[model samples]
Target: MNYTLHQLQVFLKISQTLSITRAAEELNLTQPAVSIQLRNLQDQFDIPLTEVIGRRLYLTDFGREIALAAEKVLNEAYAINHRTLAHKGLLYGKLKVSVVSTGKYVMPYFLTEFMRQHEGIELVMDVTNRQKVVDSVANNEVDFALVSILPPHLNVARLDLMPNKLYLVGAGPTGQLREEAEPELLKKLPLIYREAGSGTRQMMESFLAAHQIVVKKRLELTSNEAVKQALLAGLGYSVMPLIGLKSELLNNDLQILPMAGLPLQTVWMLIWPKDKQFSPVAQAYLAYIRDHKDAIVQQHFGWYERFL
Candidate 1:
């Protein structure tokens, strides 16, 4: 294409502000320079981009189409520049990670030291349910994903990060059931379930099935915080990752039911598409996890020993 990125940027700015003077001011260029760039871009396309009418400027149909293309082009160019910097041994890049809801509780601690060390790295973390995390991984939309249970369908490069233990917790009746009859806890208590697509919910289902326990569902919650709050309010008993309940557990606001086959243990993992190569930022973070995961987990979850 004859149109340069500089000219396209100038045109896009003009399209956004609808004023040559304003665009020039925002771009730190003279009005004449902005106009010249816009003119050059329009010339390359052989189309009139903007029209002045009644003291206002508006983009023509062709201009609007080109503006969309310009936006995509600029975004791709920005990504390329960041990639180039990363290849040059500069940590100036963005790292996008999709994490399951419960993983949110642990990922920040893992990221803190890494981020502190790499000042130029921009971290974008997407906290969602397990299914969406998997979708992002499948589509290669994110650099990595943090999840407890990996889906069996997708081929991924997996790294075990730490242990995630699921606890049966509640406020009132649920605890009484644990004390009253250990085996009947699952069958008798009103159970609050994480939504169907969640990894926690999947684990809960598997546990229930393996033990031939059928419980009454009291509620379905979408998030870890929501489930925790519900359990605290005596809404019902729910299975949750222990990492998310540190504060409440420490404060004794919620009780962990000491039932048989309790504290279901699973590994927290970092995964990326098998077909894609890891970026420097992703590689660095993965290496950090490999080197320091045990220390970090021990530091944050030292309280775990008291329960044992």
Candidate 2:
């Protein structure tokens, strides 16, 4: 039997609520109509859908199977509705965005501010490592990603929404270490770098490579905080983005070492497909990021002078 969208919807309602009376109330249909729809669907599949157990309705094995399929059909119908709505400039749908863990410190402020301005839009954020963020955007799993930097040819489009300066942090020995802690300072100490494929790590490597400052013996770790802690513990010094430890530097827990030609300044980028640009709401967020990024840093870092 050919199933209609209404029948699929009613069946899903019953499947979710597990009560024919409640499903009818939700669909604004009589109980008899709801029962008839479920029967028609069960008959089409030639299977038993429900059984009476202890005076409560229970799904038979076949009924459970059909309910799952029916839910998928209902979901697809909703997706089609959303796609049409999107085409009409509605911008009122789930926008999945992924970001590297480090960007969690900065990107959210811009995104939250944008959401407050566009109340109709719904946002879903998936925060993970930098590699995962890039992969999600590359495979179309996420519509956009905010990361420190992208690969040389990552098969996507990118926009540097705002400038992001790298900071050399340490609470270790001063003078020899601090004086040589600039972007070109990697050669002076055993540099503790983030794991490979980290947007931050990769950017730092490329910058150092460009300046011909190969680290003497590079040690790799995973998180930004770990690197900072190691530096403060006097394990080794590391280069990190200013966004990650802006507060620590300001609070005197860490010191930003002064170095010559070190920490080649890069920026946080809003990355997406070269083929599929961005939705109108996404464009708006990008604009707001550029306009208000400096203010965001000033608010979070406390002492605005450090950022400059």
lDDT of each: 0.84, 0.75
Clashes of each: 0, 5
lDDT of predicted model 1: 0.84
Q: Estimate, for each residue in 1-308, the C-alpha lDDT of model 2 and write its tens digit.
A: 69888888887888788899999987879999999998887677766788778878888887788789888887787788778767876656667789887888767776776677665576878888977887787688877888876645677777665666776667744767645544555677778889887877877777777778767755677888788778777777677887777667767877777776655577778788888766676676667777887677566545534465
Q: Which structure among the candidates has the greatest TM-score?
A: 1
Candidate 1's residue-wise lDDT over 115-153, tens digit each?
998877878898887888999999999999998887888
User: Would you estimate the TM-scores of all the predictions?
Assistant: 0.71, 0.63
Q: How close is candidate 1 to the true structure, as a TM-score?
A: 0.71
Off by over 4 Å in 1: 1-89, 172-180
Task: Give me the candidate number with maximum lDDT.
Answer: 1
User: How accurate locally is residue 162 in candidate 1, as Cα lDDT from 0 to 100?
Assistant: 74
